[model samples]
Target: AQSVTQLDSHVSVSEGTPVLLRCNYSSSYSPSLFWYVQHPNKGLQLLLKYTSAATLVKGINGFEAEFKKSETSFHLTKPSAHMSDAAEYFCVVSLLTGTASKLTFGTGTRLQVTL
Candidate 1:
């Protein structure tokens, strides 16, 4: 068991619109938080990560996330949604439990972009 929850199973946004995806987490130790974007059959690309080095982390393609320890949340956002942005987004947490580093994933949030 690790910390991290994506509140929405799916979200829809029109092209050129803003996009928001929610995520919450719980961890016993400091965690390495990450938001990964997967495009159709492609491998996950790291959108951003928090490693206790920063509170607010910015990622590629106009995506960003803020780490709020008080709220136990790390939400991802984008200023505008592109037609190619339609894909599966995963909110994940990396933890070192025992001797291995593990990646725990939320159920996942699907982004539907429409023109």
Candidate 2:
């Protein structure tokens, strides 16, 4: 089984400041990891993905995450925060089960950007 844990349920940051959202994962087999963002009533958007290609993956809007196999972590970071960045972020783990792919989602981290 695969699972993900988002360390923070809520993260607050001032506009133009740095942002960090921590995540840890576990899987018996090699896992495909992804970060997704949802703004207000909008649909989830893919931020980035790690599929054993690179340890460091960059995403949209200047966001990035590093896959650390040793620590079992894939934490998201951004040098600066924007008001548009305020939303719900999810840490996901994907696995191929039979002929289908199953995705496991974290509880999620709600990002709040302040002025």
Which numbered prediction scores highest in TM-score against the true structure? 2
Worst 10-residue stretch by lDDT in candidate 1? Answer: 1-10
Best by lDDT: 2
| Clashing residue pairs, backbone N/CA/C < 3 A, model 1 | none
**How many clashing residue pairs, candidate 2?**
0
TM-score of 1: 0.93
**What clash count goes with each model?**
0, 0
Cα-based lDDT at residue 112, candidate 2: 99
Per-candidate TM-score against the hidden true structure: 0.93, 0.98
- What is the C-alpha lDDT profile of model 2 across 25-112, one tens digit per residue? 9999878999999898899999999999989999999999999999999999999999999999999999898999888999999999
lDDT (C-alpha) at residue 45 in model 2:
97
- Per-residue lDDT of 69 in model 2: 91
List per-candidate RMSD values in Å. Answer: 1.2, 0.6
Q: What's the lDDT for all of these models?
A: 0.91, 0.97
Per-residue C-alpha lDDT of model 1 across residues 49-90, encoded as one tens digit per residue = 999988989999899999998999999999999998899999
